[model samples]
Target: MEKEKVVLAYSGGLDTSVILKWLENTYQYEVIAVCINVGQEEDFDAIQQKALSTGAIKSYVLDVTEEFITDYIYPTLKAGAVYEDDYLLGTSFARPLMAKKLVEIAENEGAVAIAHGATGKGNDQVRFEASVKALNPYIKLIAPWRIWDLKSREDCIEYALKNDIPIPVTKKDIYSRDNNIWHISHEGGNLEDPWNQHDDSIYKLSVSPENAPDTPAYVEIQFETGIPVAVDGVKYSPIELLTVLNEVAGAHGVGIIDIVENRLVGMKSRGVYETPGGTLLFEAHKTLEKLTLDRATMSFKKSVSEKYAQLVYDGLWFTPLKEALDQFVDSTQQCVTGAVKLKLFKGSCSAVASTSPYSLYSEDFATFGEDDVYNQQDAEGFINLFALPLTIRALMNHNKDQKNKTDKKVI
Candidate 1:
């Protein structure tokens, strides 16, 4: 009889590399490693070779960068879903796409089980398993960190050394990182301590603000239906546009965030993220929304944005709530078409100018000088009617207080 097969999500990192070897030894199963490239700057050939040498029966590198930007990143960008007012959902958004591809490969290769390197704690496990269950419920999930005795990054390193498995990380530099086209997130090591300041050497995608350029850089971004289409009057594809912005904004140290966030596993984790391109796009999109969307719609959308951020952070991407939220978000983007000029200085991006054909802002009605569009005298009646309840309540309170004073005098 043929041996059972398990497809493992391999990253050629310390944990997953060790898990690849352990799965083969412990279960005596054929371990096929699948590495999905979602714009993480890595050599696919080298990672594939490393996986195969470390006891993987076979290895596959799937390039899904285009799909990642067009489908996952763009939709999240349009929704304005920033997790905890800082994180751009970099790691949160990548998991579902990776899980989707993992299920596809499992079905194609006739594998019975899929495995991941996510620890017992953290949101990645939830994101991975939730996606797998949504796509292929019958497939068994083999999470090594939860089931195996090897605990902590140190234990995994020791296991790798004992088993003669080649590992990429060392004990001294054991920062757990996740990178993509959008951003790079750094956790663990000194970052685990919330009070400790992040060393500047940790940032990979952006420069230190202290070393940023003295002069501010000005750029114009064009958007259509809430999607960024061009930069500095040059039209490019979504991926190309972001790539250019990353270089320009990164030079000025624009998008670096250090925060202690609540993890989905009932613990707090500190992380530093660099998101130059994502930061620029978010600012540009928001500027356009302010011009096109009405006050009421924008206010309601703020509420929706918060819920959307929570859903993405909790790894609930492949659910009905997310889909419904997306529908509502899509409807609001119909008139969000415009161009915004932004000034990028050391660690800050501000809108300098914005214009749109669909803008709700009318200069004629809002002018300080005399204007026929809006009557200045109409404000008195509007204010009186609007404050009727307050006016009546104040009068009633005064009358009661006067009656009390008279009663006290009689006593």
Candidate 2:
């Protein structure tokens, strides 16, 4: 008589393959599953043989794709974190690294509780139980779609057709996707209709800016202190430089979006996403941080990239203010090194040129055919010391309107 181990973050789909046989027929619990690849073009030996043919006394898959591109997509692409600025949080920082590898395989399988299949209406069940209560606050967490009786995806596809269990998904194209290598979202059927549009056969990883490639491609990239290794000049290693910029920006359709967001569980969903090579590495690291930041550190890193994209889209990735906003985004990526040069087209990508050897752009102090670093009459003593407080508030509103016109002629 022995049966009580849990673990499960499995993903052979159809809701963790019917929550791995509904957590062993509703709580007899022995499931072990894992599966934290992070690059999501799965097969992984058929999802670890369908998690040991759907009962999972044990089954992992852990590739961590170069520790998910050097610890969560290069510190959220060196903290230019996006989210509401159109999400590149990519499944919000890959569900806190798949809940820290399901609490490290439930503390190496002594497992007492860790299930997940994230669905009590989504934000990935608070990003997989707040990253397993911020990395093991004494494990125990199971979720079974917030306590199951299988109340939906068509009653868990009729309880995986009465537990014969080989599911993928049906009921005519159930969307709810979530791939990796940087992005692929989608979200429930007809993208939960915010005026239902999404259907160019739900374009997996791209191709539908009116069926792309009519021409226009460019693509240069390079970066360093701010990550991305190389593309055109060809260096590639962070997973072959994002798989050759997601196959040349998904053949020109360049990262699709389609938002409607706002869902830290307060609801307002409607997704779509795609992010072909994380939109050409976030437009070549924001055009090499506008040729190496500065303008008050690029306006205080745009409010620390919107509070680091709302604390990594609200999962709060192992806190302490996201480790002091990743040390202020690694001191603004040192000198954000550079290269840029983008183009893409069809769905438009832009940033068509940038250089940076710490460039603060100087074309000889921005010339209009001028010469000696100008002092054109020193701009009238710097516009009278920058309009000295608007000329002393317009001479104190003209001496309070001439003392109300000499007290209205002595009343």
RMSD after CA superposition, every candidate: 1.6, 19.3
lDDT of each residue in 1-411, candidate 1, tens digit only = 899899999988888899898888898889999999988899899999999999888999999988999889988999999988999999999999999999998999899999999988899999999999999999999999889998676788899999998866444665878999999999998888888999999989889988899999998999999888999899998778989999998999999999989999899989999999999999999999999999999999999999999998888889999999999999999999999999999989999999999999999998898888888799999999999999999999999999999999999
Error of 2 at 228 (Å): 5.2
For candidate 1, report its TM-score: 0.96
My TM-score estimates for the predictions, one after another, are 0.96, 0.37
lDDT at 95, model 1: 94
Q: After superposition, how far is residue 346 of candidate 1 from its true place, in Å?
A: 0.7
Model-by-model lDDT, in order? 0.92, 0.84
Candidate 2: tens digits of C-alpha lDDT, residues 231-320 = 888887888789788888887778898989899878898888888988888878987887778789888888888888888888888989
Q: Scored by Cα lDDT, where does model 1 land?
A: 0.92
